[model samples]
Target chain A: MQILFINNDGGGFADQIKIPDGTTVSDLFAQRMPGRNASHYLIRVNRQPVASDAVLQPGDRVSFTPTRIEGA
Target chain B: MRSASRALLRLAGKIHSRVESLQPTCSDLLLPDADWSRCRAAGRRLEKAERRGWRLAAVRLRRELRQAMEQLRLEMHRIEDRLTASERPPRIASLREILDDLRFLPDSFDEVRWDLRQEMLSVTTEPIVLEGFPLGRFTISLDWTRIGFTRPYHVLAREPNPAASDEAVTHPHVLNGKLCEGRGAVSLRAALESGRLVDFFTIVDRILHTYHRGSPHSPLSEWGGVCCPGCGDRLSEDDLTPCERCESVLCLGCLSGCPACRGLFCASCLEPCAECRVRTCRSCLSSGAGCGSADGSECFDGVEPCEGGRAQNRDSEADTHALLPV
Candidate 1:
């Protein structure tokens, strides 16, 4: 039931990480990064939109992509 | 007998001359078109000229054959002369030392990355005003720097202010409702040092909230920086990810949306969600029933079905393998 979680801009080296089974996409993001808000990131499960409450199944893959904020 | 032989040879020579005379000249055949039918038709008008070519060639061949016969006769009449000519001079075999001299040739030169260093210099510093919401002004600095062999370009840096109760303008980690303000000079320097320069043009869409009603000049984007396709924000090279499925190379800002199935995909290769119609990676295809063979449509486009043009064709398997993967 291991799930693969990857973040492009995770601020650290582990761009790809494996989470335990039953881990949701939202959960993986929370575990990998403690303080960062999930709302700020565009979290996708298996290439589809998923709610934060949705639990991840075995073999599920998740991505944490950040939304662009504009400034000088 | 010699006279009759000469006459026969002369007749042969005449025929050969006629053929040679009938042949087309190189200039006459100047046109690139080599169609035999057109040339044949044209040859009707050029029968005499075209015949010259064959005649000349035949005459040349016959002359050579006659010369050979004369030579044979001479050899038979003068055996001593033939024997004397048969002796050959001894060959002086020797190895050349020129190759040894070539060892002194200079080796080719190339440059290594470590040998090069990037230099950064601040060009200008000034305060920039943004009249948009949560309205405020910040100090912006212009920097010009060169990276390796690349030409130098300009970058804009803005000071960050960390919001704190003490408001000493000294703290680095203060949040002003997602926009920290009033950070100290040292912390601000650190933030500036860490901050990456992004393109102003690409992220202009995001700054739509800040556009003034009657501004004469449009916002300018930084040159040579990669932009996020999704939000137009500038992305650092490391943060840039190219999608395997759709071939969209994007920054973290616009990295979502699989090109194949419109499914959400991350910078890393991950499958699309089961609930969504967006296309995901090859690994996740089996889990989603609709994918791979969803609604009976083909999972992959551009590739022909099992028995189309490529299926019947052979000898192209190597070409197909090379093209499809990339």
Candidate 2:
């Protein structure tokens, strides 16, 4: 499955990424952010907030925004 | 017989003529002297009636005015009483008395300064350990003048957690990084009146414990989590929305998104479209069809212009440069 991911970091970037079916939000976060804490970032799907355990579907628009942007 | 009837009819005619001659003629009644006398009698009666009516009206008006004045006087007296009551200063302990009470504090507090200008007593306590967390040097300010029967003596921490970033942690009831304990003025007054430094220290200790524990009781906690600025409801993190422009964290109720650009905004920062009633940000308003008119008559269509929208537009224009990059 493919999803559109919007990352509001460093000039803001949006890209489509392929993920395995039934991938949870936490799995995606761990894959993208590596060792960073999940609580430090706000994750949203389709412009709406979603839980870490929420399963992702194809074509879902997800956004990852840091809770506090540095130097903001 | 016929001659007798004729004589009778002649006599009746003479009597009628005599009666008519006794009555005054229309021309005679028209004379000024006669008319004036009649008019004066009627005028007196009318004048009497008018005077009586005016007197009655005046009496009623005076009564109403007197009642109003009495009410106003009573209101003024009530307000004056309240003013006197509130303006009466609370009984406060003198500087010497406060310093004497400071003897109760432990020897850990090394330095003390009485700021006469600010009416505050500043104290520096040595580094303390609470729950395995080493609290660096802490400065406490106790305001004497502000402490009394009703007013709460404020206890503030000047340097809270010297080693940690100020933004890294949030302390409940702490304003501007100062620890403010107690529910309200009454509780605080009681604590201050106790004149025990241990009581004050306990509050500081609790603040530090709560900070280290990362579970300070927030007023918004009762509402399930942080309160939404828009609806005043408690919401969890999952239900929150961050404003793209102001970065304000708000709940769905207090947040609106532009349908065109999908940019989230706080309720106060978003403007409703004059046509569809959908909320839109200023950027969307300029670029999209948010400002379109329904019938090509006016940009606002037939809907009344929202005061918030107008004020927001004016404010946005004033800060356009700062807001544009966001």
Candidate 3:
């Protein structure tokens, strides 16, 4: 299934990507942002906050925004 | 309520059009990105510069860090904080998506607003009280129409609570109305370029909500303090002295006392009297002190022209032009 993934972290970008039908929000986050703790990001599916185990559907808009972007 | 929602949708559309109309400039924003990177790198270098227990290298690196910050400031002045989606913004958000982003904001964000005519989208963050210091709420406004490759935003202090040491610095990472996005710049650009309005605002809000001790424009501990311009020492407001003449507040050690009036004044406000050569404030000498002779300015000292004064007081420039060997 294809899902729109928006990663609002370093050099933020959004692009449609192919994820397996069973990919959970946590799985996608681990795959895309390796070594990064999911606790730091506000993960949303279809513009609403979602649980880590929530399964993403095709055409779903998913975004991962850092909850604390460091300021100078 | 319908009207308000429609207005918001229109505001979102204005941003959509602006983001859509951007022409990627020939120049890449990498200049500032590089500058920003250098700044961060410079910060890190200081910590590692003296790992071998040598101090000279740390000093040199500190100077380099200052230079990098200066360059970043200069480059920031040159570039518009806009987007740069090379070939064109990818998959510009539809009006509905933009509206959805707007609607989704109220849940986590304090407030959302915009000006259709001004083409601006704004988010008012909840009061940012960092480390027990209330810096007041900030308004993060995005000039969506100015959207280029990066987000064009400015943060305004709604209640105007400024740093005690520097009024212009309302927040540690913010100077005046602009934010020193620092490490957040790249992510903000990415979100803006992709028309992820929600992400863009949230990222900025996160930046405001968070603080970096090493990269602050000004620290919060000094929020209630002042820096003495004379000695360059940080001091409380009561510890400073106000110059009697110029009214510039400075530490007492840097001030000079006038000989005649016996009053304290800044060094610049005291001039040496012509007669006794005493450093005197302007009020001590009569207004007519320098207005006596034919030159109108030569008659100094508020006294009768002395014997030596007559010799140098000759007004005749006649026969004085003996051309010397040049």
Best by lDDT: 3
Q: Please write out the lDDT profile of model 1 over residues B75-164, one tens digit for every residue.
A: 232233223222321111111111111111111101101111222212222233334212222322222222111112222223432122
Interface RMSD of 1: 34.9
Residue B254, model 3, lDDT: 73
Candidate achieving the largest TM-score: 3
Chain A only TM-scores, each candidate in turn? 0.72, 0.90, 0.95
Ranking by DockQ: 3, 1, 2
Quick one: ranking by lDDT, best first?
Answer: 3, 2, 1
**Model 3 TM-score?**
0.65
lDDT score for residue B117 of model 3: 74
For A1-72, candidate 2 gives per-residue lDDT tens digits of: 899665443213345789999999999999987888888665877645799999999988676655432110
Off by over 4 Å in 2: A1-72, B1-106, B116-119, B125-138, B149-152, B155-170, B176-180, B183-188, B211-326
Best by DockQ: 3
The CAPRI category of model 3 is medium
lDDT of 3 by residue, B220-239 (tens): 66676778898887664545
Alpha-carbon DockQ of candidate 1: 0.03
Question: What CA root-mean-square deviation does each model show from the true structure?
Answer: 43.3, 45.1, 9.3
Query: Second chain TM-score per prediction?
Result: 0.18, 0.32, 0.57
Model 2 Cα shift for residue B280 (angstroms): 10
Residue range B255-318, candidate 2, lDDT tens digits: 7666556677887677767655766777767654454332223334345434434555555566
